[model samples]
Structure formats: C-alpha cells, structure tokens
Target: MMQRCFSLLFGMLAWSAAIALEAPAESHPGARAFAAELARDPLAIEQGLSEAAILATLDQARYQQTIIDAISRPAESKAWKDYRPIFLTDKRINDGVAFYRAHADLLQRLEKEFGVPASIIVTIIGVETSYGRITGKYRVLDALTTLAFYYPARAPFFQGELKQLFLLHGTRFPYATTELMGSYAGAMGWGQFMPSSIAKFARDEDSDGKIDLWNSISDICASVANYFTAHGWQTGGPVAVRANVDKNARVITPGSLEPVYPLTQLEEWGYHLGSNPGGAKPDGQTPVTLLQLEGAEGTEFWIVFQNFYVISRYNRSPLYSMAVLQLSEAITRELSKPAQ
Candidate 1:
C-alpha cells in the first residue's frame, strides 16, 4: 500500500510539471524586454508595480494596425492648398468665435498673463480638437505601447513617452495608465499634448489641486497658453503675410522651416510684399523667411516672421502653422465685425 501511494504521488508531480510546460507564455518578448528595462529603475519598483504587473499591462496592450497606417499619412504631409481647407473651414471659424466668446474672460486673463493672443490660443485648440469636441478615443497605453515596441520609425521617442506616462501616473495623476485615452500618438486632452508635454506643461488652472485637462476648459486653455509661452510665442507679433513673387523669380526653398533670412534679403531674392499684408517691413536686421505654398490658383508666397516660427515650434509643420494662423485671423475678423 505504501509503494502504491508513493507511485501515485510521483505520477501527480510529473503531471503537474507537464501541465506547467504546456501552458502558453503569458507575456510577449517585446513586453518582457520593456518590463525588464522598467524593472531596472528603482523608482518604478518603488511605485508598487512589480515586474509581473507591468508585464500583465503590456500583455493587455493590443497592437493597432490602424494606428500604424494613420501614422504614415499625417496632415502635415499634405500640401498647403490641400491642408488649409481642412482646418480653416467656415464651421471651424464660426465655432472658434463662439468658443472665444464663451470663454472671453478666461481667455483675456490668459492673454494678459502669458503675453499670447486669445485668438491664437483658440485657434490652436480648435485645430487640435475642434474646440474640445473630438479629442481622440484610442487608449493611450495601447497606442504608446504599440508604437514604442512595434513601430520602429520613432521607437526611441515613443519609448521615452511611454516612460513619461509611467512616471506621470506614478507621481501626480490619479488614474490608471490604461484608463487614459488620446490620439494614436498618445497626445491627450483638448490641446492634444503628449505625456511628456503634460508632465512639463499641464497646470491646475482652476486650482482644484489636480490637473484635469480632459474636462476642465480652464486647465486646457491655460495649459495650451503655457505651452505656447514656454515655446517663445511673441506677444503682438506678425505671424505671416502674403508676398508677390516675380513671375520669373527663382524659387528659393529653405532646407529647414526655421527663419533663416531677413525680409530685406528675401526682397533682394525677388519676393515683394503682397495683398493683406500684416506688420510693416521691419529693419533690415529682423530675421524672416520666404514661404512657398501651392494654392488652387497657382503657387503662393508668404513672408513668415518670428511668431510664425514660434507657432511651428508647437507643430513643426509650416502647413500646420499656416492653418492655425489663418484660422486665428478668420476668428479675429469675425469677432471684430458687428454681430448681425
């Protein structure tokens, strides 16, 4: 009886080992790698996130093929003619005016405090999320995890953002990492700021003791203004102006979007001031750059000033900066006119 009992115990032990071997792996290799990296940080371990828990979170992240496809075709890739109408529509302009009027007191206070224009602030929010109506729906964790591990194009950047998300949740944010939602790139809230941007620029404008950008208009507007001011947005400065190019003018394409030349040098290069001009020509020393955009009628030219460069700092695309500038101008014009 004793021999038989020992034999049954050994068989049960062997079966348990076999079942363990047959079980599927719980974590992906990419997730394991990220988990290992995260475990190396003492703070992450201190935050009560065990390696197993981190791996579980990563395992739940679904790789989004749609996000991969969308990342390849950003609006910034479109030509100015194709891009302008996307953001500068009558609806967007009208909505921006309404949003401005609705939040005029807060906006005026932001403009006074930050030295940034209220119209520009409204235009940024309008262009980013359609006046806070269409903030993205994708889970930020899945987006950042997929992009950080699977998408190789900007993996390092996304990885840093993923780390920032962890740090943000660990430090001040009260929600779970999986609970936050944003763009395919993980840009969150009305301003569509990345996790790193939130960590650095998000503010509790309402003094509610927590930064609630997702629902707080005051926080959203103030955060947007803070980001712009932090990026060196000039107060009461010209953004851009239309320019008349000589029919036979040489097309001087700048290698970068940065303001590399002065207005005097651009005039020497055959770009003359054109219709609906903004500020007067500055002294020969003020830096400016010539911008060429494809219009429906023909090629369009513009002289972009320092403020234009500042706007580009928010989004490195000239088209995006132009769209925001034009939209802001439209809203300002509509607001200036008498209400019918």
Candidate 2:
C-alpha cells in the first residue's frame, strides 16, 4: 500500500514538472524549428505560401496541454474487453442502422463505386464521430501544433501532419486553417482523417468542387470508401471468423495484423474455424492473421483476413478493427430485418 501511494505521488510530481517545463507554443524552440522547416518546404512553395504566411498561420497555433494529456492516454490503450464497449454500444449500433436507412442511396452508391460495404462505411463514421454528432472540440491547428511541438513521442509524425495542414489549407480545403477542428491527434472530419489522409484520400463526392466532410454526407462517405478501395478492400471478401484453437495450437505472437498464414496452415497447427461471421467460405489458401481478444466471455480467438487488415490501415488497433467489424455486423443484421 505504501509503495502504491509512493508511485502515484511520483507520477503526479513528474506530470507537474513536465507541464511546468513546456514553454508557451509561440516561443517554444520546437515551434520555431517547425516554422523554419515549413518556410523552405517544397509543398509550402507549391502552395505559394510565403514564409510570412507560414509564420502567420503558426502564430495562431496555441498549444493546449490537454491535447498532450489526451493523446498520452488513448482509448486504444484499454484492453479489448474495455475498449469494445466504448464503440460497440447499443446506441451506436442502432444509430448506424438508422443512419444506413437515412442515407441508403448515397451509401449504396459509395459501396457500388468503391466495392466497400455500406455497413462498414457507416460503422466507420459511427465509431469515429458518433455519426458526426461529436466530430471533435479541438481546433486542428491547435491539436497538430500541440502534438508536433510539445509531445515528443510522436513529434515527427505530428510535425509532418502540421506541414500537410498548410498544403490542405491552400488546396483542398476552402476554409481557413484556423477554422478547422478535429480530434486531439489532428484528424479532421466525421471520419477523423489526418491531414495526410485528407490529402491522399478525401473525395469531392457532391461535385461541389470542395470536399466538405462536415456537412456533405456524400463527400464524407465516399472519402471513407475510397480509402478502403485504395487499401485493397476486396468486394465480397471475408472479414473475420472465430477460431477454434487446440491445446497444441502454436503460441503465435504476430507483429502486426498483416495476414501471413493461411487457414489450412493454422488448422495444421491446431487452429480451426469456429463462428463464421460473414458466412462466406474462405479458400484454404487465403492468408490470415490470428487474433486473441479478451472478449466478454473470456479470451476469444479469431482468424482475420485481408479485409480485416484493410480496416486496420485506418487505425492500427486490432481491437478497434474488431469493434468496427462487430459493429458493422450488428448494423448489417439490423438492416437485414424485415420492416414490421
């Protein structure tokens, strides 16, 4: 008990010292270095933004200590048993079904054009922003700048995103950089797209010549579908199946969700199919990855395929991917019911 109390006190002290050490965003050395890099960056040159323009924008990016606190303890850090319920709630599932019904025509078009399932697309939006009802409360500039200059863990990644923000502002986005809002990690829109994702994957689906993810459902949905299509989302492909593991099943620790083994090979190694969620037979040669999630029942095993991997590209957590798959499954089943 004494040791635990000491640890807690030490943690609080360390946190306080860290916060105290951080200079204001405007005067931070990291912020100045970031501005220096953006001034000479080729993308900034292409955008025709001068050094003054970049500084003018950077000057508005006030660091929020809360963003650092939020990113430090991400929802993905939770166990599968804990994380699943956050997204796969009864309300989220029901809302997904209703959202599907309301946007059936547009969702259908997205699925048809991109070869991605409408249910999957709907689940993405539901999980990301609760169907746009809670897009985020932080400004994109603040979030990105805070993480880029203040958060050292992912400083390089966020710095790149900070640079991309300018490119997006000058080209794809019609709004000012200061007007954009997103998650603490600087992902924008209903889908929570990072600046890089918006640059590469966002679509102008409504033909408005501006991809408005906030108000335009067509653009938001299509942009998500296009991301899937680009990442090799196979039409009619299997997502995941529960695994029946034997006592002799190899204790495999996969480095990533990338499918490296086939079902037949897994079966040879004492893992076989259990609940086939998609009801589609995967070819014995299909590459798959084994996942062990701490489900409500206990430690549950699953054999996930390329389609599952594709979903992981959006956010690398297998737990997140599983929640999305399960939520989409629930929404799909609900949508399939006959209207009373």
Candidate 3:
C-alpha cells in the first residue's frame, strides 16, 4: 500500500520544505506544551506533523556527523575485486555456517511458517549485518529524524517512517532505551527494516510482549521471515537462475524494475534460459531481466525471477540484490557439504 502511495505521490506536486526534525529538548517545557496542544486538538496533531513549528524544529536539528560518515562508506566503493573478497572470506562463510547451525530450529520454523527459504533469510542477515554481529551503531531516532527532516530526495518516506517509530514506541512494538540503534537510513535489526516495515510486519517470535529488533535473535529471525512473507515471497520458487544470452539479445541495465515482455519474447530476442519446465516456459511467463555483476573472473550474469524482484524490494540496488542471492547460494552449498 505504501509502495503504491509512493509511486502515486512521486509524480505529484513536490513540497518544498526542509526535511529534518529538531531533536526534542530533553523534557523541555515547549515539547510538553506542544504535546499537550496536540492532545487537545486531535486535528492539530494531524496538521502539526507538517505545521510550521514542526518543520522549524526539524530544520533546526543539527546534522549528525556520524550519520554522514556511515552513509558515505557503502561497501561497493572498493569495486568487486575488493568487495567480493570482503564478503566471501572463508572466515565470513564459516561464521555464516556456524550461525545457521546455532539457529537451525528457528530457521527451520521460519521456513515452515513463512514459506521463505531459511538459506535466503540467513543470507539476508549475513549480508546485512554479518549474521547480527554488527547491526550498525547509530541511534535509530536520530537517524530517522535526520533523514526524514533533512534528506529532501526521500523526506516524505522517512518522515512517515519517523511517525511509525514514534507510534511503535507506544504500542506492542516497544523498545529498550539502549537497543534502538541501527543504520543511518533508520533500518533496524538483522534484516535492517525501516520503521514502517517494523510496525507492519515485525513479529514476536518468542511470544514476548515486546517485538524487539535488537539482541533478540528469535524476534529478529521471525521479523525477517515475516517481511519476506508479507512482500510476496514464493515458497520453493527460484530466486534467480544462471542464463546465457547472445550479445544481440536484450540487455538489462541497472535500476530496471519493470517487467515489460513475456519469456517467449525473450527467447525470440536471442536470450536462452537455462531451466525450462517440461519443454515449456515457466508459469506466469513473467518477464525476466538480465543482471550483470562484476566478479573475480569477469562479468557474471543471471536471469532474475519474480522472487529476485521481491529481494530488490528489500534493497533496490542490483548489486545488493545480486550479492544477497549469491550469499544465499554460497551458504546453502556450504551447508550441503559433508561434515568434518
């Protein structure tokens, strides 16, 4: 629903407003007074969200230097030559194996309950936070507040997320004072969910009253599965498949999310699919996109399926989606190996 809303709103009028929310003064009488005013005029509460005072507060919030630093150092800067070595290290792979083993039961449960593969779930966690070893250190509130109020490109989306976070604070999705730290983009937990995702899909796997994203492995695991399930994950379907395409065939560039043509069309266009079902194309015949990722040997290519598109919903970058898929395959292969 939010996705549709975003798509519709993207083409509409662009509001010119500074995007950051001012950090609430600690127990400031002004904040209390504002809160009381909002409580009294429910309409004001709705309108106050975008009121001049609120926008002023948001604009007045200082830029967090740490957030600026973290967002700048995306893993892709080192090129695939260096980046592949970082994520595909024997240490990281072995650690992933251990993580899978330790959470075998929960992983199995998520697969059974959510119909999303455990390998995919675990791979997402691994790729995002090294299997929960490092889930960022910035305070989520500051991050969301900063991005929502200051980042003009995606301010409305982040502002909605900030609203969701505050709402979560008062609901079943309670948080501890210390554990509410996450990415500078305000994504939380092992799967790095934005606040809206957390509010809508986060589940309490341990049946605890709280749906804590930090430090609670069960909740985090469950939340990951829940997100996949909510976002149209197809159980046991291919996430992606290796494909061979002629140079004359259709070329897929980065950031292409639209499914324009049929599989039969792709075949006529000189693209050869590796997996055919009963000498016929797969059901739905959903259009496939060729994604090229730089690897150690050379350019690696794959035909991404609808499920792969679903993965893109989590992180829009083609590189990120490809990395997550490769990580999943790698972990699954390592798990299938003979035990020592």
Candidate 4:
C-alpha cells in the first residue's frame, strides 16, 4: 500500500512539471507592439489594415536604429549648449540683418496681415533652420514609427502622431509616393509641425493644391502667421519688454493668451515699458504679467502682455519663447542700423 502511494505522488509531480513547461512566456513582442498601437487608438487603427500587415510593418520597421538616433539630448547636452552660442554670436546677428533687409517687403506684409512681428517670424526661421539651411535629415514617418513602437515612455503619444501622419498622407496623397521627413518627433518643415498640427494648420500658400512644407518658404511663412493668428495674436501689441521690478512686489503670475490684467495693475507693480515696444495697447491699465528670465549676469525681467503670451502658445517653454523674442529683437535692431 505504501509503495502504491509513493508511485501516485511521483506521477502527480511529473504532471505538474509538464504543465509549467507548457505555459506561455511572459514577454510577447507581437502583443506588446499591438498594445502600443491600440493604446494610441483602439478604434482608429485596427479598422482596415490586416493583422498581418500591421505586424509586418512593425517588424520590418528599423526601430532600434531610429530610436537611438532620433532622441535629442536635453539642453544640458553639449550640442544644444554649443549650438546656443552660435545663435547668439555677432555673425548670425549680422546675417539676420541681411535676411531682414532682403525680405523687408514680404515680412512687413505678413506682419500687417497676421499681426505677428516680422522680426519674430524671421527669428523663428533663423533659429529653426538657420534661415532654411538645415531642416533635418531623418524621414518623419520612420522617426514616428520607431519612437512609437520602441520608446516605451512616450510610445502612445508617438503612435497617435503616427496615426495623424498616416491620415494626413492619405488626405494629401492619392497618387504620389507618401513620404515625409523631419525631426525625430516627426515635426516637419522649418516650423517643425507635428502631424496633427500639420493637418489642422498647414496651408497652401503657393496655390499648388499641395502644402509642401519641406521646400516652400511661402507656405512656411504663411502657415506660421496663420498659426499665430489662430492662437490670438493681437494685431499690433507689445510682445515683451525690459522691466524694472519693484523690490516690494510679492507675486507675478505669467500671462495667458487673454489680457488678464489692466495696465494700471502693472504700473502699480513698478513696471514700465520701453518706448516703441512694438505698438502698446491703450493705456487703460490692461493687466500684464511680470516674468523673470535667467541672464549671464543678473536675472532679466520682462513685463509681458497678451501678445507675448500668444507667442508662448506656439511653444509652452518660457526659454523657447524668450529665445524667439530675443532673436526677433536682435534681427530688428540689426536691420534698423545703417549698413557698416
């Protein structure tokens, strides 16, 4: 009886071992990719494409090569820091002057039509691609797909961008080859448009029925103006100003796109604007926000109005907005000078 019990126990142990061996592995590459795609859009993506095609696209995509290449280092990176000095140099400033001089009429026209400053527009072009010199080398589609499929932290957002990209391609291209190239985040053109923004805001200024952001300067300029206009750019208002902050002032909230405070409130805070700050709004005390930025020496203070806030909408970062503002100011100052 004892020997029979031992045999039964031994048989049960073997069966349990077999069951454990038969279980599926935890890491499923196919499932993970599908999950990433679905998380971006469960309904929008798996609609028409076959599972095989989807899987093949993910598999054939060069995810490994693209992810490592596309991810830009933070401003702490040597490239960004090194790149900053080049932009802030005298030669670039002189070049900015020359650029403005060459395109004075067009810049003025856009400013008049869009209520955005010509200097601001020129600066954006200068900083983005050195006035249309180096846009980017990576194909936008490849970048988006690689990041979406492989970069786990922000995969879903990139996947949504990929979806928008595909949709835009379908809407824009029926017969021609659909290919896009831009930054790692899939921002195309001198303006760096994400896929959704391209669909929503990209314009056909050339009247060619196609918006070629890659090569058309006219389209890029017009699109930038349109974007700013859509975001509430006041026709003729101050963008930013050097300010004297009172020692006693307690708090200063950043301004939003809307005019939040009256001009009276700003003056009361011991802030005053420089003469010819673009076009000042009526002196009815429109509320303004005081912003302080890091400078080489002491902190730089500026009292920004509604218009200044509008520029920030394009890029939420204060540093980016300030860069745009400073570069624009530099361009205008250089242009205003008599050629030496």
Candidate 5:
C-alpha cells in the first residue's frame, strides 16, 4: 500500500505533462479515456455493465465549478488551532453523546463485533456528515465525473473512483449511480465513503441485502465500523497524547502517518511523552508517529500509535485524526457522567 502513494504521484505527474503539452480538444477528455479503459476491463465485461450505459452516464456527468473550488480549500488546509474548534465544540461533542445514546445497542454491538469503539464510530459520523445532517448537495455523478475528467492534478485517482461509481450498480450496493449524492469530493453517506470505499467496506448491517449509506442507521454504523476494522483499528489502544520536546534535540518530521519508528527511537530524536500523557500508553518499542501541530498556545507535539494512524487512514489529515480522537474521548466522558 505504501507504493500506492508513489503510483498516484507518478500518475499526477503524467496528467500534468499531458495537460501542459496540448489543449483539450474535446469535453471530458478524462471521462472519454476512462470509458474506453472501462470498456476493455475484464471485470466490467463480467459485471454486465454495458459500455453503452457507461457512455450514457459519462454523458450525463456535469463538471461542477464549485467542486473544483471546494477541493482547493479543504478544512484540513486550516491550522490545527483554527481547525480544532470547528469539530471539537461542545455542541458536536454533546450531539455525539446523544447519537451514541440513541443507537447504543447497535453501535455497541458493532464495537463488540468489529473491535472498534462505538464512540469512535459515532465521532466519525459526527465529523464526516454531522450524523447524516449534511451528507452533501452535489450529485455524486457530477462531482466524480467533473473531478475525474477536469482536475488534472489527480485526474487518475478521481477517474478510478468514477469507474467504481459506474460499477456500484453491478455490486450489491443499492444506490443508482446518477441518483447518488455526496461531498464535493464524491464521498457518500454518514461516513462519506468514496465509490471505491463503498465497494470494499460498505455493509448491509440490517441484513436487508442492500448497503445504504444515506438512510439506514445500522448500515451506516456497521459500514463505518467495518472500515475502521479493515484499516487495523486497535481495540482499547492509544490514539495519541502530548509529548514534551527536548529543546536541544534536532527536529524530527515523519515521512508519513504509517508508524515507521518506535517510541524509543523518537526519544533519541528529542520527543517523549510528557508527565501528563493520557490514554493507555503503548510500550517503548511500539511503532509511533511524531506529530507536530500549531495549537492555540504554541507548537504541539504528540506521540501517536497504530490506532492513531488508523484514524488518519479514515481522513488523511493529522488534524482530522486528532479531532476524531478528542471528540471520541469527549463522548466517552459525557457518557460516564452521572445524569442530573
């Protein structure tokens, strides 16, 4: 999976080169090529997805100017100090507790079955879509198609998702390709799964033979839990905690969220858990991430473990992962309170 990054980068470079060389002589250059590729794909042939339908769907794809603008300025672009307050507010935390309480049995059952905490699942829903309150307004077909064919920086990635969007009809998934709605990035449901994610992780929790991310609460909860479980969510393990930096030690920036180094190794690089480190502590040999963030007070450093990295896999932003962790912990605390 590490090679996926390199492959994506190489694809971006290729797209950029092509765009620089010539003007697009046709509309949806990316979609046209993508359709051609899909027509030849063996899976597409086997799935009974008609090439004609694929072309028709691509024809219906409208390039949304707003989606382009939105992707340019994601919340993850904001500083951690500014970003934390958006999802970490009292209202969000309180709502998460209420959501958890309303579906305690199902969420807890999923937690027990999947080894992912119910609070974390609830927090993901809260973070991704405000518990299904704002899944998105743009049609998923338009968003994916627009980004697939129009956005050159990551055209290949979006195009692949667009392919998966068409293939969703062939799978056990319930939504029609054109009728689907999601984020500007084409992610759907309470968890905002992209087409590929839906294909791989979406679950029919109620056992109704269809996976519906938008309407079924059980499906939403189970699908989110399945995603976390598949991504290696560690049950009852450390997510992250504050660490004090040795003033004289050299700065250490991790290459990626994949926990590549041990806590003992980071200690030599001048980072270690402060005296007040919270959560269940991992052993010194645990592979960890040395995270640096700009906080309200000053620079913040944290030691994050595999579970923390798993959170990052949900949303690649370190800030997003931290917010999910904080919100999950906050919900757990709120639940522990004695009812007034």
Candidate 6:
C-alpha cells in the first residue's frame, strides 16, 4: 500500500512539473505594463529569463474573487471563542501528537538548537497545514500576481512578494512559478512561509542541498524553528496566562501586539495572574501586554508575555498566537496520556 502511494505521488509531481515547463514564454498584453517594471531589476535579469517571459507567466494569473474574499475575512478577525475551536480541534490535536512522536528526534534537536519548544513548533505546522495534509490548492504565481496587480490595499506588499518569488525561482528553488502551490496570499508549504520568509529563514535541515518544505519534514520543522528564533522567541518562557481583571477597573490595552507595559504596571492596573500551569510568574520588570478577546460569554482576558508577542510576529494576529499556544498545550496534554 505504501509503495503504491509513493508511486502515485511521484507520478503527480512529474505531471505537475511537465505542465509548468510547457507554460507559454510569451507575454500577455495585460502583463506588458509590469514587464518593463520587473525588468528594471538587475536580479530579474539574472534569472536568465527575459522580462517578457517573466511577465508572460505572471499574465496567466487572473484576479480571483476568492483571494479577495479570503483576505477580507481572515480567521484572525473572529473572536477568540469563535477562532479557538477552528484550530484547536480534536483531530488537529490528535494529529499533532502523532506528528510530534513521528518527528521526535528532529523536534528535540530543533528545540536544543533554536530554543523553541517542540510543542510550539508542532502546533505551528498543525495549524498551518495539518502536518502537510492541506498546504493549499491555489497556484502561488496566480495568488501573488493577482494580489500584486489587482488587490489595491496590499498591492505594494504583494508586488514585493511577486518580485521575491521570481528571485526565489531564479535561485534556491528551480521550479516554474505557476507550478508551485500555496495559500491565496502566496504563503507556501507546511509552515506557510511567505517568499521573503523562505529566502531569509528556510533551511535545508537534512543537508541534501535542497530546501523542500512541501515534502521534506526536516526542512519544514527546522525552518519554523529558525523563524521563531529570528523573531526573538525566548526559551522556557510563558507564552500567555489567563488573567483576572477588576470588572469595574478601566484597563488599558495596547492597540498593537507589542508588549508595552511591565508586569508591575499591569498589576497596579488591577490585572492579576489567574491560571498558569507552568507556575513561573515573571518578575515585576518583565514586559507584558493585556489581550482581551470578546466572546459569546462576554470577555476573556490574558496576560501575554514576550513569547506570545514573538508568536504574533509570525502572522501579526493575536488570535493566531493564542490558537498556536492553546493548540500546543492541547497536544502536549494528549501526548502525556497513556495509549488507548
């Protein structure tokens, strides 16, 4: 059965590669405007493809309403209560445990080397693509090109990503832009790294001289750890803790995820530690932030520490960080139980 599955996978990959190579090299009329723009870059020329060819490939990408709609209503926009169940599911938690055990050695080594917890790394992969089961169905070229030229709000950012994608295609990864698949926003692989993130932090963990996040578990896990370490993740630190706040007291929550207040200041403002399993309370001088999530049950409060803020750096979403933390906790708890 495993042999048959492997053969089937190989066949699909070969088919995809063939399709990518057959893509037209001529520029589409719509893409001519961007062709000169992309050609101005020396790096684009270094890719060995003419500016027209690059833009022609991009021209095949159409403006997708699904992309616009997906970006407009991200999971982070939902309240904690609503968002929590989406990622912290029974299936995700169970599959996370299985994945952790399967990659125990790699996870342990990554933690020792990068100072990121194994559970946290596992949770990230689980949330991003359910351990590689659902990386995405959209072509990365289509996603980035559509967003770069059509999405008015984040066009500049997507345009930059589009450039980086071309650069990545020229260098580290040798594949057609249309051949690779990823999220609507061009985040790829199990870790859902943007093109810039892949260029900056992705690693070839197995030392095979190729970084394949789609199929290489070692690269995927290590790349995630590298990203956390780069973003200043503190080892052995609390991610967040439930906090009790006075109902009548006016609490000041920072508009951003960055930690702005010290623990002493938060305590003085009527925030007290509520439930912490790790049992390590930070010192008075430790930086913290109050995260309040509105739910069906009214409101929930959490005291987010440095690690929580670091997690937010990945996606800039408090809900996302919370999901990763809670999912990690759930996976750890499940792993501790005896086999059924």
List all candidate RMSDs to the true structure.
Answer: 8.6, 6.0, 11.7, 10.1, 10.3, 9.4
lDDT of 1 by residue, 124-177 (tens): 999999988888989898788878877889998998898778767743567788
Instruction: Show model 5 residue runs off by greater than 4 Å.
Output: 1-26, 275-280
**Residue clash pairs of candidate 3:** 19-149, 19-150, 20-58, 20-149, 20-150, 21-58, 22-57, 22-58
Q: List the residue pairs that clash in candidate 2.
A: none
Ordered by TM-score, highest first, the candidates read 2, 5, 6, 1, 3, 4
Q: How many residue pairs clash (N, CA or C atoms closer than 3 angstroms) in each of the candidate models, in the order given?
A: 0, 0, 8, 9, 0, 0
For candidate 6, the clash count comes to 0
Local lDDT at 120 for model 4 = 79
Name the regions of candidate 2 deviating beyond 4 angstroms. Answer: 1-24, 277-280
Which model, 3 or 6, shows the larger TM-score?
A: 6
For model 1, the superposed segments whose C-alpha errors exceed 4 Å read 1-28, 41-50, 275-277
Question: Per-residue lDDT of 260-318 in model 3, one digit per residue for the tens?
Answer: 55656667766667765213456547767666667778876666777788888888766
- Clash number for candidate 5: 0
Model 3 misplaced stretches (Cα beyond 4 Å): 1-62, 76-82, 176-179, 251-255, 275-284
Q: Report lDDT (CA) for all predictions.
A: 0.84, 0.88, 0.70, 0.66, 0.85, 0.85
Q: Where is model 6 more than 4 Å wrong at Cα?
A: 1-33, 277-279
For 120-153, candidate 4 gives per-residue lDDT tens digits of 7778777767777777777665677667655778
Ordered from best to worst lDDT, the candidate numbers read 2, 5, 6, 1, 3, 4
* lDDT (tens digit, per residue) of candidate 5 on 5-65: 9999999999977654333312655556667779778778887666676887776666677
What's the lDDT for candidate 1? 0.84
Residue-wise C-alpha lDDT for candidate 2, range 135-189, written one tens digit per residue = 8899999898888887888889998998888888743588788899899888889
Q: Comparing 1 and 6 by lDDT, which wins? A: 6
Write down the TM-score of every candidate: 0.87, 0.91, 0.77, 0.74, 0.89, 0.87
Error of 4 at 146 (Å): 3.8
Model 1: lowest-lDDT 10 consecutive positions: 19-28
